[model samples]
Target: MRVFFSTLALCLTASFAQAQCGGSFSGFVNGLKDEAASRGHDRQSVDQFFGSVRQDPKVIAADRRQGVFQLPFTDFARRLISSGRINTGKSKARQYDAVFDRIEREFGVSRGVLLAFWAFETDYGSFQGDFNTLNALVTLSHDCRRPELFRPQIFAALKLFENGDFDPRRTTGAWAGEIGMVQMLPQDILDNGVDGDGDGHVSLKTSAPDALMSGGKMLQHLGWRAGEPWLQEVSVPDNLDWSQTGLRTTKPAAEWAAKGVTPRHGQIAGTLPASLILPQGRKGPAFLAYPNFRVYFEWNQSFTYVLTAAYFANRLEGGPVFDAGNPEQGLSGEQMKRLQQKLSQRGYDVGEIDGILGAGTRAAVQDVQQQLGLPADAWPTPALLNAL
Candidate 1:
């Protein structure tokens, strides 16, 4: 849910034909005033600003779009790192080289990763969404769907108003409450965004310099390491506990090489530790993902989302493909559930037998595969099902 943008815009102000929410909104303003006062913030302006809020159901539905329910890895990756994005990234690589270089030098982060984020967030400032941030957030907070998570963000948005991050009158973003060219959440914008242009203010929407540097600063804050590949194609070693290694902890490059793994580019930064992972399945590209790469995953939990960002970063850097070979058919949702149940029955301790294949389930599947003396791919297949 990292990349969700938390864009749950329950537009409390959109002119939908729903029941009149003016009373409810007025109550909310009263509550916000009390809350702000309790928090040592000025209550007058906060009340005035929140005086005219309403619920936007359209935003809620949009946030819950089925496209995100079970997006295929291949398709998600394609949508993110498209040809247009790559081309633009290349141009930006040159256009903003000075800024990027300075950022990279200061932060020890990769320009490509930072630029990829900027590109993915708002198409390098091409089209920031036109939704009203305050309206959307206020609506989401009132709605019970994610009130706890969103309510705090709404408060943070108010703080932004208090501190003058942007003019509340014209600040806009995605349907949810993300703003600017990089689509920063208000909370993150407050905490991480830096004034890169030195213009005495930071605005991600109108300042490419500020947006890019803020993005880079975020990666730095997230623990990016310089002179290290975010991720790299690697040969999965024989008998390696591939499942446990994935996104759990990284192993030293030499240890992986000792287990028959080898960097595809032979530029093994040998000093860094990497987590071995098989994205889709066996016979697919194997990657030893670095910590910074894992940080990208922190931003977007989807493997495909992070992979696309990293892959696009590489594309921007003129890096080669990480294709391992022929990939296998990924497990469908039902199949994944079945696999989880089977693993649980065999005593793997998957949290629940629900079809959601998470880290625990994948690790358990690997354990089952190892015990069964399979190819050790850790993939759920008909044959593996037959074993049960």
Candidate 2:
């Protein structure tokens, strides 16, 4: 009787677990169907789209485990702009020289810059992701964390299907619904997709020319300057004021020159409106980011990503590597979390306590550094943590 009761309890637990999974996902899908239909999507199309869509726990897990934002700029940039990646980018550039020339002539964006974005986004299309686009988008839309952002993407995916641009059965991409060689979102595809190969259909996934041209078009639409340097590596003087070393403060090249900042390689003649960005802090490396650098922010909001993409583009053009001034080690995730908590306790709004030192957190750190009469580099250091 005891064994029979134990077996009965195990069976009940399994049945309950199965029921919970099926019921919760089914309800979420029904709600998504209603929402999509209300947003002017065809009811039949919405039903067909959501009918076979299963809840992807893997997508949710991937979203929660995004660690790239937590890494220091030096580490992140070094990994992405390695010697191997630079060689591959150059090879791709030479392989598609004619296509890039045409794209550059039409869009006025650099071929190397486009190649950098492609390499960074999906490793030159070698691994564009394998998650089903529809399932991923629908699952993300059902999630409560950022439903507003993902819902529109789901509608965009549906519209792509309606317009005969995407076949749902073969459409696979990143976990967040980004598709194609350059990992463009659904709305981006609809807005900036171009038929570079001129086959009458803009298939960015299979056509290299189409993806490259579409990326160029997207950058052009994002206000990429015709002929402007994105950023230049520079050496900052030791006696320079530490307060003037962030993206928030813009000064002319003449002003920086007056303060003893010089380009590492070339010359800074004109008074271009540029900002001094110390990526890893005052001790790491300094860069004079020009107006065109903002275009990279539009491509990706992460400062590390934008800087790495720009740096990689420059490397492809035979630019020199960064000056080695960064520290041997940076803060770990737990240390960063502790620093953020301390900042919050002192009334500095560091945004989330997620250990990722973003703009808000950096600004708060700068404030603390200023209060403590230290160099306001805005970078979290072990000494800074101890001071806090």
Candidate 3:
């Protein structure tokens, strides 16, 4: 109720923004008319459609909030792995083993990553959000902060309506107007929604298969590699170029071996390019990642998220817990960046030497630590800096 009232108030204030320009309703009706003529839609239905879409401010605010988010990786990981999410992920993973296996086999993306996303985005679709997508986008588009960015989405929603794809009054979605189970935005619905229930129409909402498959398709489109693990737990030796094993770029397994780094499991079986990643200061789990890990990066660029996702996936696979007992001392963001900068000066690329300790920076730090004959946890410290 609060959301609805807030939306109404925003529209009342902003009515002048559009009502003055021959009115929002008139413009909407006109656009529908063009769409109707193009697709042979009747005039009355078009008018009805135009009347149905109202501006939604709550959703706009929601989108605005999500757009500028920055949470530390550790914090993000802990939040996603809440007890509720873990149990839910486990249950869903077992229940959908067939679908997951097929998707895994075909896409090379593990079911755990898929499941984790489902858990995160909408809590296994329980909190898919509630809002009228068209209204929100249309309202936001007219809000003036960035109309050019949202106007097309509103238009797209209208196109969907005018085409009889979904009734405007009945179609609802997330606060930012993400539809159906996967909470896909309107553009994604247009491009990737599928008729998972054997219905002629494709929808992101109301169909579990449709939503999950749409998400899977997005993963595949994002460069998911088949037949490769996203990550692997590795034994970072007491001394090695551990930092160079970052996903910022590639290094061959043999190159890593030359630095005295060995996998906890054994020597890597092939010449696959891998990156070193240490998520928890030097005291925590270290990972060897393949190209597929980059795919996880594509979905959401958080070293913490990808690492935890991989760990959760490992749990799903019955893999052992990380043998590294504790996190090495953590580096402050400033100290970490300086460490990264030093590594870059020494010919290791840690990606911009940013204060953020992303996988690239960690790998660069590892390389320096190994060269210095220090334990290569990739968690740089003042002591390490003092030696430099």
| Top model number, TM-score | 2
Please report the candidate that would top lDDT against the real structure. Answer: 2
Give, for candidate 3, the lowest lDDT window spanning 10 residues.
1-10
User: Per-residue lDDT tens digits of candidate 2, residues 59-154?
Assistant: 888777767777887778877777788889889999999999988899989988998888988899998888888888777667776455566666
What are the TM-scores, per candidate, against the unseen true structure? 0.83, 0.90, 0.67
Clashes (N, CA, C under 3 Å) per candidate? 8, 0, 17
List runs of model 3 lying over 4 Å from the truth: 1-50, 64-71, 105-108, 139-149, 162-167, 242-245, 262-269, 280-283, 321-388
Question: By the TM-score metric, which is better: model 2 or model 3?
Answer: 2
Worst 10 residues of 2 by lDDT: 1-10
For model 2, what is the alpha-carbon lDDT of residue 354? 80
Total backbone clashes of model 1?
Answer: 8
State which candidate, 1 or 2, has the greater lDDT. Answer: 2
Model 1 weakest lDDT span, ten residues long:
8-17
lDDT string for model 1 (30-140, tens) is 675677678887767676557656567776776665344244455566666677888888898899889989888888888888778788777888888877777787776
What's the true lDDT of residue 286 in model 2? 85
* lDDT of every model, 2 decimals: 0.70, 0.79, 0.62
Higher-lDDT candidate of 1 and 3: 1
What digit string (tens of lDDT, one per residue) describes model 3 on residues 1-388?
0111111122232423343221474475465457445666566766777676776657666755531113344555565666677777789877777777666665566777777667766778787666776676666655665444454455456667765676677787666556666556565566556565577777666666666677777778767776666667777665554444445547886676676666665456357888776666545667778777776655455566566776666655656655655654566666766777777788876765556666566666767777888776566678888788
